[model samples]
Target: MNPRFTNKRVLLTGGASGIGRATAERFAAEGARLAIGDIDVTGANAVAAELGGVAFAYDARDPAAAPQLVEQAVAALGGIDILLNVAGIMTWGRFEETSPESWQRTLEINLSGPFYLTQAAIPHLKQCKGNIVSVASAGGMHPVYGTSAYGISKAGVIAMTQSASLEFARFGVRVNAVAPGGVATPMHEKSTAGRGVDPAIFAEAAGRNMPKLTDRQACTPEEVAAAIAYLASNEARFATGTVLVLDGGQVTG
Candidate 1:
């Protein structure tokens, strides 16, 4: 009955779905004060009500909106100690088949969004000596044939985590990423865009990302949420600039 996050304040992005939602629930159960944000205001509000927190409609892809979002979250949370960036997108297709617009949009949501949010949250996070945990992808570490855009964006996330960790550690801020492989979520279901990705191709990609121990299966969003919680906790105080790969041994090979 000991709470790991008693009296802590957290500002979570993408808190309406997937790993983000799971993370928000986990933080709430641990006694943290929470403020959830997402493009889906209705969904965010629903989760916020359940946690006794507030929700804000946020579009992370818009850099100019980050400061405002951070202000709103901080206002709700009373202060910010954790900035969890879990919002992301998957653009599944061949590099040649992908449009420039799609590629840019993917990076904007998956990479730039986190970057801008972090920039705006830093002063607040610095005040509390907080940490950041981003949801990266196994595809970032081990590229999938048709997921070039998504993979690149996640790779950038890894780099950002490391670089930001290095720069922010001096100020007592930790930065890390959780790289999950083929997590079973709504985002995963949307992996196909036009002609649809081939089942064999998808299976092969999963096989490559998940090793024998996983039986080539996707993990639940809750599992990924566990990793994020650990990284954000004092248990990982000495850890920073790290990518915690929850890839089921795929990266090991």
Candidate 2:
């Protein structure tokens, strides 16, 4: 069978690790030409080398970096057929306890970053009728304790996804998001590691807000990557303004 993404050019953020790395690998396997951007220069370059793609040093929190990253991708790959907004950060704290710096930083990385990247890539996406797939979180859809800032940032992503979908449908460019619950990623591990939040509190929160499924395990990066791939593929041509929740019944149950 022919590869699903043969001749497609894809630009991805956070491509050094976690869901972004997995998604990059998947796209490469499907014959995509990739341009990976991440703050982890060494890691990004390594992935790019292995995948025969290009890598850029990117800080999603920087507005200037957004256009620069897109420009670099376009220059390297000729044009972009897909954009993946997978770079984000999370901090654990209740609304009252969350520091202003933490809140601002979370919003900048998780929400504003995607927004900037999308704005920069829109023209290119329009030219190719390409689609975008963002990695939102289930926390956005439901209240999760000690994740006020993180959840709000993801909620903005969900909102942006739908808004972009509607505004860009006339251009034949689709925008969609995957609202995954806890995914087993280094990002998650690091976020909780140094944070003073009690581990039991997270467990309690998860018990209340997550995994209505029998297997309450966090999702694998590959699983979320697969969902993202589906949303970006021609298989989902008719889908737009859609938030595919991969939260194991978190919303429903």
Candidate 3:
């Protein structure tokens, strides 16, 4: 193993599953000292135990939780060299069809959580000249028929990444993001399961969301994780305020 991050301290959110879980594994394999944060305490603890890292319960909807997670992570790992924001959710609905409650919840977790986490971690990150990598979505860049809340939230993330990069550049803290298209993750099944929305609506949308060049319609969590890892790595040292779009030509098409 290259172990590019040997001894690097990392604090990652959404580490319980999907892109977050894959990102945690990637960082651990690269020899990072990780602190996994997630709402799924059991799953977060499991991942942490397997990787010999610490775990903290984190709910993205709770504004106060971000600072606490950062504090706990800094305490656990000494200081943070990388802050990976991979926790997010997507709810399916057109603008009018979406509920106010659903919209608020989506924004809280997908947008506000990262906002709060970044603010809390900036001081520590500045001390280490650390980098930040967030998982954004191509939906933020392109027009999808039925994902207003998710799209808007992700758009805010992209804006946040860029804005932070500009402000933090003098401090030597790099901020970048990976905007992936649809990914094969549990969020697809879990996000809309109980809602009255028809699952076929998502299916039809997925069909139309295909990449122009690649045969695959969606990326795997590990694939997105790889992009996240790259952005966080020294290999991408010169990159900041950059969004590496990993949609396999979906947007360009």
Candidate 4:
């Protein structure tokens, strides 16, 4: 099998589990040297062990820690070629029920974290003419009830991608985003658990809301990982500043 990403150095955040973990495995299987980071040291190390890579315990939302993560990844992998910002938190609540702390934390993790990490990694990425793929959300494009902060944060992510693409294009470093909808990840499960939402009712409502697309089946993490891989691969060399929506065609008819 021809590995598309053979020998590439990839730095990924949120590699402890869920979509991030799946992306790590996908890139590893493509023969990429991975530098995985997450708040969970043990989990990150475990994934790194399986992939024959290095792990760093770093909080993506910490501005000061972001550069350290880039430096450490570069030190371990020799240089950075692909940076995947996947660390994020999801809070579900109506605007009235949302607290200031909740809003700030959501934006800090979802928006500010990727911003800081991307800024920190740009130097190495520029050196390698690398690319960045951010995990955004479908909520960013269409308004969803009871997800004010999450939606706003992801919207900011798309905006950031556009701006970064413009600035980095001259340097041959591409930046893009993937907006996934209702993926069957740990984060999605946590966001729905104990929310007083009947599974059948919610599914029915979602199905009705997305009529033109396939049924309300949640996407798999591997599916999202494939999109990320494409955005970060050489095939997308000319693509930048674009938000690829993977929301089961919810945004379309």
Candidate 5:
């Protein structure tokens, strides 16, 4: 209705649920044409249909899937004007309990996925002078116990955001990332539920991780999506190489 993104072509990974799903809805409401890519084709299709957009099955764990997802999205949307990289996973375990496999999978999804997808989209984005917004985590900023791999991976994403911004500025493509603390998303639910880790424990840790002046509270996916929209909008044209932390002010004082 706002038409902020009227006729703008967008490609989003992890669009099946959580922040990604919320983002798709927000972008659609703002009048953007979308190509939703998710590992879950059923959910992706559902969101895409609801938004009058197309969907693609995307498995960020697979290195090859990045280029293919981009190709499919380009074919469906004509060209990419905005890329939202929200596809990621959580691997919770102590250092001793964490496996090499777990590290690989987490990194592949949370770190490698964004890297490869951004690399693949750079050319298309350069042509359109588009921008990117990635979903990092509060864990990336400060270690969240029991999620070393997830934290490391997300930290990598945060770094990649700034690095890419510097490299792509000359091409007129902006890169930014959001670092959110705990959110009431499926991923958070799955990570905490019946896992022997008390929910309050994370909340407490999240609170302690932030500046003493700040408090901890779980935000909704839609709330995070709103931030992504701003960074990708014309409003943030002068902003780049920035990591926006939306963790109830935990990351900052």
Candidate 6:
């Protein structure tokens, strides 16, 4: 670890588990003072305790909660140096099969949640010349058969990153996004299970769909976290509005 984020204040949503948990650990290891928000209070607290950080039980879908999350983070950590929007939801279904409720829920968590949080964090991030990192998905770049809502939501996230980057540039706040493909997270496993298809069959289909540059094996949350950490660090000062894809050569190949 470069310790680039030493003493930095980082606020992360969905810091309870999966990619978010990995990211929280990564930042903590790199010497960040973290404020994590998640609906899973127990899990959040456990991770916070381990990292010596504060944890808030929060549902990111509520717009009003966004400012509150920022306020709490600032109060706990002094100020915000990085804001990472890792909170999201996924709904697996064909476009025609997706209900309006499911679509709304997905958009609320994936798109609106990040929008509200980023809006609330912008002022503080500007003050610190900080950065924002949003976790998007490879689904945003290429269409996946059963990820209509998720893909659309992630696409919105990428667009939001670009727009925010341009708008916040004069304020010295950088915005970027990461799009990961086939990460071996619990979320992925759950999404794939009992879908009336063999796990290996689904895996093979996914592997075949990815670009040649992507590795055959799925990515790990830690690997994605590393990319996120780099983008949030001073090492990427000149980088903004870019989406770094971590799909094991899926997108590039």
- Candidate 2 per-residue lDDT, tens place, 3-88, comes to 78998999999999999999999999999999999999899999999999999999988999999999999999999999999988
How close is every model to the real structure, measured as TM-score? 0.93, 0.95, 0.94, 0.93, 0.92, 0.93
What do the candidate models score in CA lDDT, each in turn? 0.86, 0.91, 0.89, 0.87, 0.87, 0.88
Clash count, one per candidate: 0, 0, 0, 0, 0, 9
TM-score of 5: 0.92
User: What's the C-alpha lDDT at position 243 in model 4?
Assistant: 87
Q: Highest TM-score, which number?
A: 2
User: Poorest 10 consecutive residues of model 2 by lDDT?
Assistant: 189-198
lDDT of 4 by residue, 193-218 (tens): 63554454345435332424566657
Ranking by lDDT: 2, 3, 6, 5, 4, 1
Assess candidate 3 and give its lDDT.
0.89
| lDDT of model 3, residue 71 | 94
Clashing pairs in 1: none
lDDT of 1 by residue, 117-208 (tens): 98999999999899999998888988877789999999999999999999999999999999987677788757632236666556656534
List pairs with backbone clashes in candidate 4: none
Runs with alpha carbons beyond 4 Å of true place in candidate 2:
190-206
Query: Which residue ranges in model 4 land beyond 4 Å of their true spot?
Result: 195-212
| Residue 110 in model 6: lDDT | 96
lDDT for each residue of candidate 6 in 138-172, tens digit (9 for 90 to 100): 98988566677889999999999999999999988
- State the RMSD for candidate 4: 2.5
**The 10-residue segment with the lowest total lDDT in model 6:** 207-216
> Which residues of candidate 6, in runs, are more than 4 Å off?
194-208, 211-215
